[model samples]
Target: EAGVAQSPRYKIIEKRQSVAFWCNPISGHATLYWYQQILGQGPKLLIQFQNNGVVDDSQLPKDRFSAERLKGVDSTLKIQPAKLEDSAVYLCASSLDPHPDRNTEAFFGQGTRLTVV
Candidate 1:
């Protein structure tokens, strides 16, 4: 597996600013996920995609966050008018299929650390 890949290892911006992170999942991975991990807490599911379509984004802050997997290969997550509370690590992961019955494995990138002041 080529493994999930992410860019911009770190970023720092003032409140109300904007930033975007990129992710490239492994080849042949049909399911991609984006997660947010705050300090001292477990990672939270923000969004997921099956191919180029969004499977679930209910947990994503729509007003301030947006994501897309245009070609079912790569994805991007953008946060506009960022807030201080948004400071956290944004992780990108990919899996073969997230079937409830199948125990699929996932690969994750190191993630991008964002600091909003």
Candidate 2:
């Protein structure tokens, strides 16, 4: 199965600088998600979108992190004034529906590793 695509496999930025990551979800997938996985920790959901409408963004740090899915397709995540604690592998995932069932399952991208120096 073809996986979702993410750009900039790795990124390193000084603390307080800004960084952005891009994602291209699998075709026909209607639900998209973004997650942050800090070192030694499991991936944590940051935001999710059903089509172009935001379904959840409770975990996203609105003050520093922002994400948007344009036209219900490609997505971008940006963090400004990044902190050292923000270093992580950002993962993008998508599914045919919001809830997984026998027919549809979520697919994840390879992720973009971000390092805050």
Candidate 3:
């Protein structure tokens, strides 16, 4: 009955510092996703995971951003040497299936707002 969970609702750091965010998806969900949303822009898919294996990560910035879904349950996203452009909301979502045509709707957690100074 519980929804997805995310930690550290807000974070602020200097441009060169590193930050990490955590997420725990709902039970029975098989598809988990991480998104980035800058102000005034729609969320952009950064990565997608089907269970513990990565399904997509083409949009993720390998230079500084990384994510992982451990044990097909909890997930973590990290940004090292953060840039000013990294200031945005990091959203975690999950669905019962991976196909976009499926009827299942993704449930989102309270996003982590990152501010890079």
Candidate 4:
């Protein structure tokens, strides 16, 4: 199976600007997730989708961050008016099921590193 794919391995923008990132998951995978990883910190779940429906997005900054997985295959995340604190690595991951269990392990993409000045 193909691994997750992400575009623009790096991005730089000024505060209050807007940027977008894209992700493509493995074939036949029905679960996808977006996470933000700050330097020296673990990945924080931002949004999760199961077959095009959002399963969780409690940690996502709704005011500035938005995402969608329309066909349950690929997803996109956008940050509007990016803040200085938003500079971090955005990672996309996928698994066979949306729920976490002992059997499934999420595969991560290389990630897009965002830098806000």
Superior candidate under lDDT, 1 versus 2: 1
**lDDT of all the models against the reference?**
0.95, 0.93, 0.94, 0.93
Global Cα RMSD, each model: 0.9, 1.4, 1.1, 1.2
Per-residue lDDT over 8-49 for candidate 1, one digit per residue giving the tens place of the 0 to 100 score: 999999999999999999898899999999999999999999
TM-score sort, best first: 1, 3, 4, 2
Model 3 TM: 0.96
**Each model's number of backbone clashes?**
0, 0, 0, 0
User: After aligning candidate 1 to the native by TM-score, how far in Å is the CA of 18 from where it should be?
Assistant: 0.5
Off by over 4 Å in 3: none
**Could you tell me how far off, in angstroms, the CA of residue 79 lies in candidate 3 after the best superposition?**
0.3
| TM-score: model 4 vs. ground truth | 0.95
Candidate 1 residue runs with Cα over 4 Å from true position:
none
The alpha-carbon deviation from the true structure for residue 77 of candidate 3, after best TM-score superposition, in angstroms, is 0.2
TM-score of each: 0.96, 0.94, 0.96, 0.95
Of models 3 and 4, which has the larger lDDT?
3
The lDDT ranking, best first, is: 1, 3, 2, 4
Local accuracy of candidate 2 as per-residue lDDT tens digits, 1-117: 678999999999999999999999999999999999988999999999999999999999999999999899999999998999998999999998866544557799999999999
Candidate 4 segments whose C-alpha is farther than 4 A from its true place: 99-102
